[model samples]
Target chain A: MSSTLLRTTPALRGALRASGALKATGALSSASFVRGKATLPDLPYDYGALEPYISGKIMELHHKKHHQTYVNGLNSALETIAEAEGKGDLSKAASVAPLLNFHGGGHINHSLFWENLAPASREGGGEPDGALKKAIDSDFGSFDTFRKQMNTALAGIQGSGWAWLVKDKSAGTLNLVTRANQDPVTGPYVPLVGIDAWEHAYYLQYENRKAEYFEAIWNVINWKTVAARFEKS
Target chain B: MVSLNTVWQYLALQSPLQLHSTMMSGDSFNLIKMGVTTFALPALPYAYDALEPHISAQIMELHHGKHHQTYVTNLNKALESHIAAVAAGDVAAQIALQQVIKFNGGGHINHSLFWQNLAPAGSDETKLEQAKELVAAIERTWGGFDTFKNAFSTALLEIQGSGWGWLTREAGSGGGLRIVTTKDQDPVVGGDVVIFGVDMWEHAYYLQYMNGKAAYVENIWNVINWKTAEDRFLGRSEEKNEL
Candidate 1:
């Protein structure tokens, strides 16, 4: 992750280091430039570690196949955009927006998602503590309440998308929001925790019973990572 | 004997000639001359609530009016931009627009066929007996209707992401019934006759069925319009008899 952080600014690198997110090495490259290639990151834990809650099969496919596609797509879109812009083909460059948004968002979202998970035997599941816990309680009533609300948001998503627990920078408040497809959490809201609602995330294990997947995933959620992100935000 | 596949192959070759004429024509910016057709949402043949219990009215309204309509709307918008790009000879822009066109266009095509593929839950069209030829083919291919149903259901469940399951027939001689799947709004193309397609996207069943996908797949048979499938299946035979 530190090596990949080479693409980002020093301030972002500092923030990431402070948040303890740097330990999930190789999970993200932030943004890869035209010449930079976004590669698949190494998971902090083994695939089978998140078992019972999220099957190893699902994890392997999600991380390898799905995430790899997004990485390849994002790198390709960035290359195309750079080439088009170099040719002074502004229209052609602009036309690549959808691909950039889809693939780029996918890459960012999955990178965050992997860090937010851990094996149940480790720092996974359980409630958050310290400043992060206080924020969750204050903004969303109680931890239990916030969990239920997040689950509800996950269920409400139509087609394929994600439900994120985000923080409003100005207000210092936590909010739950949903994004259609791979539309990443951006703007003023800093995404602290994201749960994938796309069918591929859970279809193999939970089938169409997505609510179970949503509910069960919490068992493997690395609160430490989320807390770090929340505190940093 | 001229096989249904050969007849379809002959017809398929004619499209490129028409497309070539449209491209070669000097009418710049003429959408009509380019043969770019604007797609519209087709009205459902039955009432929204007609497939109640199996598929709720709310789901139908949203699936047809909202979901399907969005596809039609976006596809038209993409086509408009695509035509402009073509006129400007912006090949890169045109290439970029291809994906959007494919996604939205496939959505429109799939949903249009999906609506017609279903009848009222207990209606006469739902009966397998009504589609004798298709039923016979199913029996011939899979040995029984139940076996075919199970296979179709399994395929629908196996789709990893958003997609559709279809029963299609190959064109020409030696081609027979086959089951296939397409991911993320990809419509069935080529020489195959699409007997029917079942929408596997979560929006198709999530609201009404709510994660009970197997149940949704099971109940879908109750509303399947086998009559339409029979007609599509026997179309070539009917033409052959005329000849």
Candidate 2:
């Protein structure tokens, strides 16, 4: 790396920033986007490290504000869900179901997204090796096939939604399923890999057509984390 | 994996004054008439940290207070002189300044469009049901809403570079479902009327997804204000003429 970039680098800043979830930054800092007690997730790396891939600005807008809103909304909705469930108010809970699902799902998806993404030099966001590749081949015929399938499935989602590669514990396999909006995976599975199909997930850059963003995000894949997920499953 | 090396941050820090004329604008705006950065940062639609988890607060601060603001500031400067040139008797200067004016101007315009494109994740409007007509139109034109998303997403995914992928509709055209990519600084409005636009320019994404444009696009959906989008769609009928 160039000394110029290395000089103004970010270090330990992510952890410090994550700790900031509990406090208001300035007089204008908003507590509205926060609802429940969950803390903000620190970025895996500095804001600029993802440069050339993700801009520092988009990252700032997307992570700090966008994801936090979901976290806050999820916390708020959960309170209602719990109260309704506690009272055995299934119908009421059902009424609030969309909120829990969308916001909670948004929180969950963004949390996973932050963890899955990383800078290029790190082992975080890069191409998979060995077993992950082999699995990609066995399941989808080839990496390209897997990519095409993922993009198609993700783009094919209607309205607000998500596309996921969930690890079905029962079948002992990964399944690609697209969920409408924040609908959770109501099955005996874990998300091996997933993509958030929301406009804020991309829009500022990729715009109306989501396919391009999906195809391009492959560059920063933290395949190692995914491999770990596969092993855990 | 798509190569991250392929995408680079293109920051045109050169003042628009060079590209534009030397004259200035006396026209008043919503801002102060005096000293600033010759550019002012744009305001974010929501509070900072509104979209968390999916996006980080630090990223938002820099993205909004820094990146988007730079574009807005630069655009204003570019336009200040271009408008001045036009006011004077400099047709050639105005013509030559068009590209810079458009690029920076479009950047500001597109980013402004983008700021509202999202809502707090999970902010669906159950109280409002105005999106039905647009949804119905999608089903009619693209076979189904699902099919339209597929085609639209495909257009976005397959675009070669940093450009927008939009679903434009005209009076005669039910829906121009196509994926269009603009080279650096070029943004094509979806409809002549601009139902809505996406800012695929790198400054928009370089913060979060880096060169992983696909991931950025997918995440954008979480915050997409379908209601607003639906409104844009509703304002313009597929087969009706604007005139």
Candidate 3:
């Protein structure tokens, strides 16, 4: 392996584990062994579970096709990098870093996304209780206001992207941020809740009415999962 | 296209008729050069569907007619306001226009280079001439032509979102060729001269390629105009020597 890949792979795996998204999915094997290959994590619930809010078709395609492609792409990129490294070509390995960021980000984001949602039943779409609720109130004035801000941000995405409710771990405060395309929420914030605004996410059901999709998603948001992410972060 | 000297002359006269005549004669470059700049969308060098199979007609049409046109329009609008802000000495307004200028200006610049960099498959330009010094530079930097192509394609596919992958002549770094990626419509702003660029934006290929960006990147190699790249690389090199 290239010296860079050898040094960076373990650190990247550490960051992915520390991200809490992989842990939330319960699919990541022990960090010691899981270095380069990234597999698609199975959805926490059945495909049809998040019905009415997110249709079975969207869930099935998003997971099996979209997320799976990223997993495949990530593994392929890793293999290419390893091959380049074997030849002692560090620049060739460096060139594929963006592939790593995109595919690895897709895996991490979708893994969190599947867990971040649930059917309206089973504690899916209601107001948060306890500490999570207090944090939301403290961060954005009130839950209603936070919802409004997040919806506006999600709707305003010009192209394929995601809107996130992330926690600034150091400050212990929640912040709303948006990422273009499959970019994962990195840096000081730990992603608490992420809403995929990619057209493929809601286009079949909602069509051009992205605002409606954004509004409906609130009904199926797994706040319990979000709270767990926040607590862990 | 109007020469920079024509723009200087037109600015002195500031005649509406002079401007209209220049524009009617297909000299929009003067307008771009003048502070009253209005950038028109450049006509595609080839047909909308010229590079078929490699790039679908629909993708090319939408990408050029719609996407590129939007950038041209927005860039003109932004520049119009920006000129006024500068005239008024409004520092805040100038600062606020920075993002708009970078996004749209970058889009316009990048897309313009992108269109010229592509040719219909089977173009005579595919085979690099040994006489072309740029070919030697590319070989020296990346070991061989195939290796350079692989590195460029790999870098292009890896872009996380809407961005561009570029083959730039790094004048500051002794005129070597470098592969770089820029997020969004951020033009190659560093001291490098962009020789060729590929749009990694989904709009560039999503209609046909769907999520198969790697396929799109790989296939683009069949249509690249190496002659244009060689010209750009050599042009930058000559300019550096003149300095």
Candidate 4:
């Protein structure tokens, strides 16, 4: 299965393209297609860019090893589905749907994750200004309150998962949500920011101290990119 | 006297043993007639250490005492909130609670079934008459015990993330057996009655098996309580036949 076929449905691609987040982040451009195979999107910055807050070791392993596995799995699952469909074996496709979700979600979430961060030297840390700031204040009371809520929600996840700040397009409001083990933000919500709470994301640096990791993550958040995502949504 | 409708409802809702007991014990009839029941963590049929060498005592302790207990607790909590939401007609709240209910409820159901379907190796229960019937069925459906084991293990290993692999009797397929897998803690429900299931969740095997899930899959066969699986298969088949 090619990356193009596996990464997103045609509908999802249209949504992403419309949102302009995919274009803005240059994720679509960086995506190298070898015979339409799904390839890992290159990190926008150096692996060590978010160092001190997130060790370069973690970023390297996460991006190279962890993210790559999902790419492989997603492509494999897509191939399986295609072959099953070719044989008119829908049961085989149904059985492998979980893999598609898990791996495809992994690829999507991590792709967003890499773009969601920037170096502290690059105005990564600090508060959002303009419409994004006003939306935050209006929806979640204030920036501090939003931060606290996100931290609490992220810390409360029982297992490997992610915490998201998503735009509910229908209601036109920002909401905080959590998903377990590579489940993407589905439905009407367009994800603006996501924090990986999986053990691999922080175990080496924080060692079960999820609160500390969550706290440190804020320092490296690329607020400008998040603002762009919010605006696009 | 309970209304005839209430009796019919009770018969529809209650488990076989509960129904049988309700019929036998007049004092308990009124309580069950009102439709109040809660799930609890069942006692392990054998000592925690009984399946050691194949599965560690520590793994059993945490898997049952900690993991399974947490699921039971959370499921109860979710159900409590769900009941209130349904009573209040809070459809949004009910919708939000669906994942909570499925995760905890499936965890509870799967773990409960998993415990019953395992025993210490070489036990008398391993090869009883009931187990013989199950083996015969396995051979018939899958073309022999070894083939069935291989196919089941392959399915179990292929579960990409946390999930369960089951040998279930397809309800409308004339008692046909199929090996199926489900993601996360989703329970094997619908018309399929699970005869035997293996937990592929990391927590189920991570402590003892680590990343070597193949080893865990291989070793679990040693502890499978074939008699219990046979009983469940026979019981479900009998119920279907009666219907």
Over 4 Å off in model 2, which ranges? A1-36, A82-91, B1-243
Clashing pairs in 3: A99-B158
List TM-score per model, in order. Answer: 0.53, 0.43, 0.66, 0.66
Worst 10 residues of 3 chain B by lDDT: B2-11
- Per-residue alpha-carbon lDDT of candidate 1 for residues A1-233, written as tens digits (9 for 90 to 100): 21332244343333334334443322234333224456677788988899999889778878987788887886677667656655668788778777767777787888889999999999989999999999889988999999999999998664578999999888879999999888878778898889999977876677656789999999999999998888778
Query: What would you estimate as the lDDT of candidate 3?
Result: 0.74
- Candidate rank order under TM-score: 3, 4, 1, 2
Which candidate number has the best lDDT? 1
Residue A4 lDDT in model 3? 50
Pick by DockQ: which candidate is best?
A: 3
**lDDT, candidate 4, A1-233, per-residue tens:** 33345355643353334324343121232233222345677888888999899989788878998788887887677667666655668888778878878887887888888888999989578999999999999999999999999999997676578999999999999999999889888888889989998767875676535689999999999999999999889
Task: For model 4, state the Cα shift of residue B136 in Å.
Answer: 0.7
RMSD of 2: 21.2
Per-residue C-alpha lDDT of model 2 across residues B1-243, encoded as one tens digit per residue: 211111111112123463232233432221133221244444676887887756667667765776566556666676566556646647587666566655665555455556656677877731124367766766777798778766766667644334566555553454543334444445444234344455564445555665566676677667666676675675642311210
Error of 3 at B231 (Å): 3.5
What DockQ do the predictions score, one after another?
0.08, 0.02, 0.18, 0.17
- Listing candidates in order, what is each one's chain A TM-score? 0.86, 0.75, 0.87, 0.87
Candidate 1 lDDT, tens digit per residue, B141-202?
Answer: 99998899999999998664578999999878966999999878777767677888899997
Docking class of 4: incorrect
